[model samples]
Target: MSTDGKSPLPPMDWPDFQPGWVWLTGAGPGDPGLLTLHGLNALRQADVIVYDALVDERLLGWARTGALIEYAGKRGGKPSPKQRDISLRLVELARSGKRVLRLKGGDPFVFGRGGEEALSLVEAGVPFRIIPGVTAGVGGLAYAGIPVTHRDVNQSVTFLTGHDQNGLAPDRIDWDAIGRGSPVIVMYMAMKHLDQIAAKLIASGRNAAEPVAIVCNASLPDQQVLETTLSRAAADVAASGLTPPALVVVGGVVPLRQALDWRDGLADASVLDAIGRRTRDAG
Candidate 1:
């Protein structure tokens, strides 16, 4: 019998963190709470952790004692490590018999480029496990009270990257088909080319007055949600002085934020101030 306890919970059966293996795990947007148990488990046992720019630095607190933590984050327009070099470094670390954890923000498979790293591991004969985490496209929007899908708003939704490998808006996207078919569009890394994207959508028949929302620093206390129209999104965002690491959502469902925005109560005064500014501008 335990002292003042009804019963002790059974121990969790966690996977062993063996040396000479790499684990590509998602840290989930910016909130440490959103991290998966598997990710936490990996953190506690990792010999070395290579983390991304968007990952919450607080999560590193869970790393076991003496663990080496390396920053491998790549922010756009910043001096960052090349993808090939990063992948090769993982291979090198695994070859050194380290329990390597490549921690990325959001799901490793979604836009996080875990696939490329995984392929490199495969070619180099390094063992690895893929752990998916909550992507900002859905999780970030949820924190902002914007549902990616709604029965009344959209039956289907689309997710796309804002830019391609060349750091420019992707030329291969069929804007006309997407604008016509997708009732809701959630874009990643799109703020840089938002003006062009908005123009393309307008040319493809999407309404200029369609609702749009930009959620920045998603899931973190500093999260900001900016509301605007399709035609005015680029200008409004520019005027507001918001930066990257933001998700752009375009569709009819965006207006529902007026009622569904639950974060307002918990958000800091800056968020309220921004919202107030947007409201006054809209008026």
Candidate 2:
């Protein structure tokens, strides 16, 4: 663990991540410990850290003092800095010959708009490197004791965004195909539109009784997991009233959460019982 702002700047293994370029790195699903070694190296060496709303700020403490930190996060329905501006800023920073770190929550490439930013940097002739982190769909589910791939429950899994920034199920995605083809589904940023998303899945042949677990603030101390069935997910989540930056898992593996969940323990048995009893009731 490198101390915040004190290193004499040791030699780096990846010469490609040197100054004069931007590194788009994922900060993991909310836990600083889950940060990749490459991501941590970037944080320590960065001349600036341009981060998202979901990123854990504590991770910024790793950056050297006097490092410029920019907030570029955009939440759904909230006034936010435009994506074009954020991309332009990255180009500017690299053009200024600074070691830029574009820190994002979860995996940068996984719905983090990293591809857009990278494209902009490339078009501007700015050299860049990508450091992948643990995406929330997998890490968040693990924290909630939900395995994305279980031989008994599902041989395949599908990942989808709950809604587009416009607050509608993405028209670009074939929900019917995803619903019928994928045995397991993991959703990101879906809390607000879970009801509509659930309905679409059910209409597409997903069983209303399928188990669902919403893991909020995954991998963090304040994390909360809500367990419910597909038919009840929308209402139960609405009633709980948890905030965003959550991951939702829907499939038979949700039931395994009762036994496999090790993080945060079972003192909150309600989350576990919700799945078991709900499954029985539906049966």
lDDT of 2 by residue, 14-120 (tens): 44457789999999999889998788778877998999998999999888778999999998888999999999999998989899999999999999999999999
- RMSD of every candidate to native, in Å, equals 5.8, 3.4
Candidate 1 collision pairs? none
Error of 1 at 246 (Å): 0.4
Task: List candidate 2 stretches off by more than 4 Å.
Answer: 1-16, 267-283
Superposed Cα deviation of residue 63, candidate 2 (Å): 0.6
Candidate 2 local Cα displacement, residue 194, angstroms: 1.2
After best superposition, candidate 2 residue 4: deviation in angstroms? 7.3
Per-prediction TM-score: 0.90, 0.90
Clashing residue pair totals per candidate (backbone < 3 A): 0, 0
Best by lDDT: 1
Predicted candidate 1 versus true structure: per-residue lDDT over 11-116, tens digit per residue: 6777888999999999998899999988988888899999999999999987877899999999999999999999999999999999999999999999999999
User: What lDDT, from 0 to 1, does candidate 1 have?
Assistant: 0.89
